[model samples]
Target: MKKRGWLYFLIFAFILGYTYTALVYNGIWFKFTDGLKTIHFLLYFVWFFVAFFLSLTLHELGHFFAFLFQGIKLRALYITVFVFHKTNKGWRFTIKPKLWVLLGGLVVPDLGEIKSDEDLEKVHKKFANSLVVAPIVTCVFLFIVILTFILSLIYSRSDNWIGFISIFTIYTILLSSLYIYSFTLSNPMFYGDFVAYKKMKEDPVFQLAQISQYTMFSLEDSDETNTYLWEKTRDTLKTIPLKNSIFHIMLLTNYLDGIIRSDQEIDLQIDKKIQHLSISHYMRNEQGLMLAYDLCYYHYKQKNVAKAYQLFDEIQRRVSKKLDPKLTTYYKKKSMHIMHIEYQDEFLEQIDNYYVGNSWIFESLMDPYETLKEYHEKLPFIEYSLPVKFEEETWCFQKSMLYHTKR
Candidate 1:
């Protein structure tokens, strides 16, 4: 069984065992017949859900309002439970959102257009301040609810009003505690807002983030052709130690770009680094897809055509069916490229339009063709680009021969 499947099975078994003990051993099922007890339970259940949702909404609004107060323009606002808004793109619906972004209630701000160092510094400060506002707002509202509950008790209020206050107070406190835990705790499952806020204040982290943004812009920046700035930025990224998955992925992207440019053979050093990333880390969907594509390219270079095809097929199948149109179109183009299928000029034009419209540099960075090679490698690295074309021709010929023999 898959690890995830086994985990689900274990959870199911534990729940079943607990239910059996409660109902059969303890005879707790009889409690359902007690009308007053049942009513109280239902009321608490309803109140809990209502309070929890309200608290989460307020927490997110706190961040949103903070950004507005600081005069920062937000690119997007996402809430895991059916809320998504992007500046130009408007709203989108999807089953799952990025885990870290959803958990942290990340508000992506439009800082890429700010060229001046003074503007960048001001934006970063506001962004950092906004991160803390969610937790603070949650705590403040929780305190107000607790005070109201105390006032109701002091006045010896009617039973219904007392019950209402009591339930709201308990639920607000519980929900607020959960929010606090999510902010303060460091878990491998997802990053917390407090940790990100702290990192944003550090010079190295700030610079790295800025470099990543610029690298993204370079991919879709129409008027800019000189890659000298990109080369320098990449070198700067390399100077930082690969301490986390994000850094490792960024460095791997640099190496992958080198591979596509060189095309002669799989670089052993790059291949080793690709293999070093853990399976769990690769499960981070977007980055995982990029890593999968890199591995597929390596296999194709090694003349392992069947393995390359299989890897591409698996990743294409696993991609979210409800992805944004730009992403869906990009992945389709990628799958075709991996399979060595030629595309019409119109299709390529549409892809270019999508890239420019979406400002999608990360997707562009993963392209295994002349476009990415041109953007990533210059003059001295130009010679490396020849071998990739040769490999693609070789793989296509091999595939044709195999089909003919089978026929």
Candidate 2:
């Protein structure tokens, strides 16, 4: 239904765009032969794309500078299809990107730690700067584009000016439409900068969640770091009412707590809470898989093979149906291997084949699993450590940013 809506929207958009062009350039239509010749059209195309991308870059940089203005150091910036991400090794540039990122570029601020109200407020102020500044920048650019279009109209006396006027008109209209749509539209799952800013101002839970999510993403992979996060999150959860919004964060906290503390009763409590939360909340594909993998491990550790298999069945029903078969099978096998126990070497080989350079998942799931310690010993010790690809890295960043606080 969502896809159908977007398809209908695109069809409507195309028709509307054609109608607008026909109306605006009625006078210039006769000059098409002189104005829209191959060379001229290519030049116009190049110029439009360059200006469009430049505007997008400036808008994202507005967010970047705003965060920096609040003294928040940034870790990553995504503009269009390009990504500038930082890791332990250093900052690296990546080409492949994520969807919806092109609508408004993303900046990942390094939110050091969320230890106090002061810390939370500090992050809030920094994010608020970006939300406020980026839209302002966008509007400013839109105004400039409109002004240029108006100027082209004012001087459209020559056949040479025909293409310029028409193209600028298209750019102006397209930019305006996108600006309005992005700023105003709201949904249960997604909202834009303007609405987000309003929520930041009006809702404290939304505000705290925004801050906590980034703070979680900024964590280094270490027992001490995980332990600290578990304690702090445990404290934060005590203060706020438990809700579906913070379930993923709680799931992560519980997973880390189980590893660090190894208390069976607490682990069982965490597993039950996770199962309850999974049933209550809607988890999208990759996000659902993250939770499923954790729960699968918990069930297996509890020596409940039936429960582990049941979890996989539920995954197939609710989440894995939407996922790539390879990805689904990979995670399924990784989780089920705990019970099968005989195909340890085959599983290790598969891990070597697919899990290389995916340090976050490895450290979070496999390395910490006590059942896998023997397999780890058998395998040649190679660092399963490298920064994740652009999509997964952005997922971690956005997942934490969007879902890390109690409502």
Candidate 3:
């Protein structure tokens, strides 16, 4: 009932719907006459799942053994995550172990039918002591694989049983080791970002839980990445943020990342982050900075010298004393350097036009002349947005002309 991360709850709900739809479409359930066929598919699915899950079992076992040696109490072991999103099942766990040696469930089998959040809390509390055994198990497997590979080479000359075992174990051990690493590796996007698991791993508090959590509490661990479409959107947002939020805020690292990058990379990452602006209002500054720049450039590129200069001036005024004061100066000089040639008097006058009001964009677009106005219009997370949005909207004269003509 706690209201924390209601967004995550929504996401979980959406995933639930998506998963059910996929299963139904794929004949996971059945009418009475088709029930036998359904059972056959279910059985094979269960068998393969059981075999794969056994690997996670061993992973958790490694952690549980470490806990036992360290004299920690084990409350329960179960495959915790069930019917999550698109997947029929997932893993979570409950264990009472010491503080520093957490990560136990990662080496043992996960739980089944997690009874309550209380079960999770009990496990969460024990994280500090659990042993993160996945890495240990993985490294051992790696060493075994390497040893087998070397031995295989050595015994390839002899045709002995040891050589055969070494070759066979190489493949098994390599796959196991890869699975273990996938669980604990630090990825930089989505759930893989520095925020959740990686942050937990870095922090002593949650790092302790990595063991038990990975074994039964987490499933489908991959190095999360920005798909091309998402990355493109994020890059667009990085260059411009005032217009809209395109993605869920929770999944917006790539967009934010693009904003923080340079002009060279900005064009690439904006489209992704645009999808997720609603994630946080506090992030307005991060998102807005790039948008401010993009707006200025948009106007600049479109030959809308008036609008362009207005946007530029807005950026100049909002420049933080903590930031590079020289940045505003640099861009100003660059502006004069580029525009001074064509629209000599017009561009020069617009450069100094510090009319601090909402009408900056309107005046820029409509060519309205105004005296110094009051300053009640500084929107948070940005110095100006109307200027940028106006500029982006008007950047393509061809598009503008076509639309206006069609009108």
C-alpha lDDT values of all predictions: 0.56, 0.59, 0.40
> RMSD for each model, in Å, please?
13.2, 16.6, 25.4
Q: lDDT tens string, model 3, 60-174? A: 5665665555544343342322111112233332232231132222223232222334543444334333444544665575566567655544334443343334434544565
Tell me the deviation in Å of residue 329 in model 2. 1.4
lDDT of 1: 0.56
Q: Model 3 lDDT vs. the true structure?
A: 0.40
- For 329-403, candidate 2 gives per-residue lDDT tens digits of 656665555445334457556444343322232232124334334323221122223366678888899878777
Summarize candidate 1's per-residue lDDT along 224-294 as a digit string, tens digits: 31133234334444465433455456555555554554443344444554445433335334555565666
The TM-score between candidate 1 and the true structure equals 0.53
Query: How many clashing pairs per prediction, in order?
Result: 4, 1, 60
Candidate 2 ranges with C-alpha deviation above 4 Å: 1-39, 86-104, 155-166, 186-189, 201-229, 236-284, 299-320, 338-343, 351-407
Q: Give the TM-score of candidate 3.
A: 0.26
The predicted structure with the larger lDDT, 2 or 3, is 2
Ranking by TM-score: 2, 1, 3
